[model samples]
Target chain A: MSAAAAAAGLVLLAAVGACAGVVVGAAYVAFMNALRVPARLAALTYTRHMTRIYEAAMAAGAFLAAVWLVFPYTLRLAPAAAGFVGAAMGVYVGMLASALAETIGVIPVVARRTGLGTWVTRLIWFVVLGKITGSLIYWLYPPLVP
Target chain B: MPTVYLKPRDSLIVAPGEDITLGMLAEFAAEDHELERTLRGQPFLPGLTEGHGAISVSSLDLVRAIRRQRQDLDLRIVGPAHTVVKPRVRPNPVMAGIWTAAVTLLLFFGSLMAIMFFHADVDMPLVHRGVYQLVTGEAAPRPLVLQIPYSIGVGVGVLLFFNSLSRRKPSSDPSPLDVQMHIYDQDAQDYLVSQSAAAHRADQARQK
Candidate 1:
């Protein structure tokens, strides 16, 4: 492949990845909304189901990596490998986004229900600070896993 | 076919090969005032029975229904028992199927969109590029050897961090996701219990 063609391909991949990320983030929000009723109806079961999905995703990712290592280069497909990785990463990212959304969503309701306005604000800020700290840690450490 | 000894009262024998329902038990113990009243009041809830040296409800559906009503009733079964009751919630199959489909759809689209976004934006070539450069002397377009290891390492790291497949986690190490899920489940249950308790209290107050 020519240098110019390679550069163009790289740019296209980057653009695709960015667009995908936004869509994934949006889907995550939609998922949380969808989950709310089921969760309220059967919290334990719903939570168990979510955990199972996460575990399954993680296992699929590991299995994919194993397959990649065992299989010959001739049989390898970049798109397939990338898709599996992305899906696994998507599940993990979607979960984190959902948790963040839940935290933000629940605080106000909790505060109102309990009338602990000051406590809620303090708790929210504490969580926000913790998230900020985690982001900084991610920048420094760079996730070993996607 | 276990003979459920309604404590301090006579034992009501369940007919063999026939599943004992709350209605059947209530009918059997129609003569006993305390036992009959309790059974009639919550006729759907399963009676708690002792089996395999442990006390457990014979029917989970009954337990689920009974839990909502804050009734002080000691319904225990005694004697040698052969029944092994599994803790299960018998949900409406149609509703369960619908919810399952809904959840599956949500997860599929949610993961797909999120994956596309993250893969395209942050975790694309850049993440690989950095890892490859760190491991190998070459930059930008790193060798296949370096890239492969890094990519595989990403999967391994995720497994290790999540600790999902393993029954035992390394030392006290538990996945943050698992911890969060536990907390969420506990909070929901606590909330439900509190709501039920409050409703029970209100009902009692109204009766008074």
Candidate 2:
């Protein structure tokens, strides 16, 4: 692809990833509330989710560095590499805020109630949110899982 | 689902007749009289008013809600954690990133500076002149000021290090209410209280 075309494509991809991250995050919150998990535990799960994103970032860089050594010339694409880093951070922040907001609005209310069936349902929703975030990261970064 | 949350901590217990003001759930318990005699001077029967419903709540959601209640909450924990661990007067992350970039850049800068200072090949292409023009908005190819790149890298590294460090801090004990509930396991606590109470009971029985 032409350099300009590549830049445009990457930019559009970043924007889409960021938008999708927000949507996925919001949907998970709605789903969590419908299940009624306690607010405090929900918040901890959310914080862990954020931590996972940062971990992914550190890992991605290490992987990329390894790949660059293998592929050689690819390392010279420094600007594009930096841009990808920025995009990941941007997407992470977007999704994280949306997810937390959902938790803030609903988790506290859920904490007040009682029931085992409801608790089980909430657990499923927590996993769903985590999966959504993970999928989004995969789509954007494409983990090098050799 | 109702969202009231019990802050799960190390300390605190609630029995049916424990609350004098009936704050957590004694207020909700139907039969107060049946439990009154057993609850007297129970020392500390403080159980969560928020209750067990939030049992399914993920740990993150709980923190977010508590966090919102007090910004100080995060600052108390992560901020302090970072501060305490920070080396007494070393280069921070932001400085480090800049330094790495700067040092790399300086090497290149020194080479070019040597060229300018001594290897001033007058016959060389006006490329350097073009660089000058571009940089100064005149007609020049200014020597790639290698120092600039190093400084920029150093600046960026330091910025990143500090940003991450800030997040690593110990956030607030927003709910100073937390330490009391979580610091001890419930059974150990119950044993302690019962041991003290048992001594009192034995003393009373002896008087009889």
Candidate 3:
């Protein structure tokens, strides 16, 4: 790519990152609310913490799926760039998706019993998994993609 | 005792110079020194000169202090109170930079893994060969013209999809993320208020 094209590509990627941030940040609110309601109801009661663990798993799965859908585009574009710019952009997308996923899964001790907590927790792990998967796709996908 | 008339409800009177702690705020009954940490630097007490101390201000100053931190308090003094609430301080640059870097790394890893797992599930090579044949009307090789636009379109598509998620045209519509963030902020405010109320109740119970 020419210098101008490369610069434009980077700028485009940056915009993508910003948009991703907004999407993930918005999703995080739902995740936290999920955690909060359960704790409020199960207040001071002794319940198994494993329920919260399960919630975390489910949320993680959702997040992973969401990130997976959005991030593959960057890889498709990587071959267009002359230098590392394309791969860098791919990384940027990956990171953006991952970071958003990370913020969703934390289940507070009080909120552990609620379905929301599990939902949020799963959402968080999903992002983490999504990031890992995205990275692997970028590196391991055949040259046809790059 | 110089009395100051509280606004909205003129029935209320505050006499500054009386020892006032956060516990005296009618709504916030914090334990000793707790208010100092929680509402620190926000002038909750007028004439609070010393450290680890009670706020001893006249009723007018008391009203002034309340107004300083909380303009929505509906409690105002009649006289000129020179209290100017300070703006929130800027975050430390170094700390901000570190946080930004950390977040960036985390995002990178997240996407990396995301692609990996997704690719594992699908047949990307077959998909590529299919697209190549469809675009070129040839065996398995696609030209740069077709490939370039297709790649660029992917980015554009992603943007268009997310922009529409906000339910309005891009650049004009406020992002749904902003709305979600606002909800979280309101939740935090509500949480703080509830905690304070809970603390007050606990204190009252102890006294009873």
Candidate 4:
């Protein structure tokens, strides 16, 4: 590909990514609204304005995160602090994944198709354990990652 | 006199042409078998004479009806004072299928795009390389061990967070989605009950 063409392609992908980020952010806010998170947290008068602020903040934060990602940086943290951060990030990502899965009704479809019936819970636990093992191995033994 | 304990529901959906008995309205328990049978069998609404839609029935009305029927029995009412009776309308299978498919597709694509965009924005590969170097004291183009585990962890974490497999929830606490749906259902029922009550008032005013 020519330099100009490659540049154009990159620009297009970035544009698409930006749009996707906006859509995802909006959807997240909507999901939170549907769950009445804000209402539960705040008084009725504050909730309406709070949601608007949240939307704007999320969009700005996404853009900022993207910009920051271009730089190569490393931070040193205490092992305990690192563990805490990792666990927190894991929780956020996990909830997002769960929401996506639940919305799509993935488990029910999979169970029905495989006819796993009563065994599905056990299978889920196995997957969870496998994930924990894999993550432990990755963090503890970094040489294997390369 | 036999004392009966009655717990009324907030809302109920009844099929067309089906009789709304006292059993259908509230759950009641009595020490005496004969009284229990009578209470359960007592008719509330003979059938859907008005055809279909939401109808609000008050517990005060129910208690009065029970008193008239079984003068010898003592009644104890608990919970909501009103119940909304809605007609059970079966949705078209094709329409239901289409709706489900649309939602599933939207959610699936949206989630995928979100993950992809976030990874791209963060320059994840570069971060992975940095992390790899930091951990192993060597630079690598891609960290397959970390990437592979992380990818799997996302899926597993989601499952664990939801604490659900199929229809059954592993934990007693309800998921956020479940709570949201419940709130939505309650809102709908409340709206229907209010509408029905308004209509009843209008009819009463017109009659007067």
Assign candidate 3 its CAPRI class.
incorrect
* Residue runs of model 3 more than 4 Å from their true location after superposition: A1-146, B1-89, B122-151, B161-171
For residue B185, give model 4's deviation from the true position in Å.
Answer: 2.6
The digit string of per-residue lDDT tens for model 3 on B36-69 reads: 3443334354433222221112345455565566
Best by lDDT: 4
Highest-DockQ candidate: 4
lDDT (Cα, tens digit) per residue for candidate 4, span A29-143: 7876664444332332335557667666656755655655686344543333333434544544555645555565555544334433333333444444434444444434546
Candidate 2 per-residue C-alpha lDDT over A1-146 given as tens digits, one digit per residue, 9 for 90 to 100:
69999999999999997797568656654564443322322243346456455445545654554454455332233333433433343333323333343334332222222111122222322323333333233223323111
Residues B1-208, candidate 1: write the lDDT tens digits: 2122232211233333334444443332333477555554555424433321211223333434444563444444442222222222334668655644544444344433443454456755565444344333245442334333333333333333334435663354444344444465446445544564576679889999
What's the lDDT for all of these models?
0.42, 0.33, 0.40, 0.61
Q: Deviation in angstroms for B113 in model 1?
A: 4.6
Predicted candidate 2 versus true structure: per-residue lDDT over B49-128, tens digit per residue: 43331111123433453445434322111111000000112235675555445443443343233223221244222422
Query: After superposition, which runs of candidate 4 have C-alpha atoms over 4 Å from their true positions?
Result: A1-92, A96-146, B1-3, B48-51, B67-73, B120-126, B139-145, B165-176, B194-208
Best of the two (1, 3) by DockQ: 3
Tell me how far the alpha carbon of residue B50 in candidate 2 is from the true structure, in angstroms, after superposition: 15
- Provide chain B TM-scores across all predictions: 0.40, 0.17, 0.45, 0.73
Candidate 2 lDDT: 0.33
Judging by TM-score, tell me the better candidate of 3 and 4: 4
True contacts kept of 1: 0.00
- What lDDT score goes with residue A145 in model 3? 48
- What tens-digit string does per-residue lDDT give for candidate 4 at B1-208? 8788888889888877789998889988889877777888899886664447678898877899898877887888888878988777666678556655554444445544555455556665566556555445556576555455555555555554545544654354554444444555577678877787788789989999
Clashing pairs in 4: none
Which 10 successive residues of model 2 chain A have the least lDDT summed?
A112-121
Task: Say which candidate scores most in TM-score.
Answer: 4
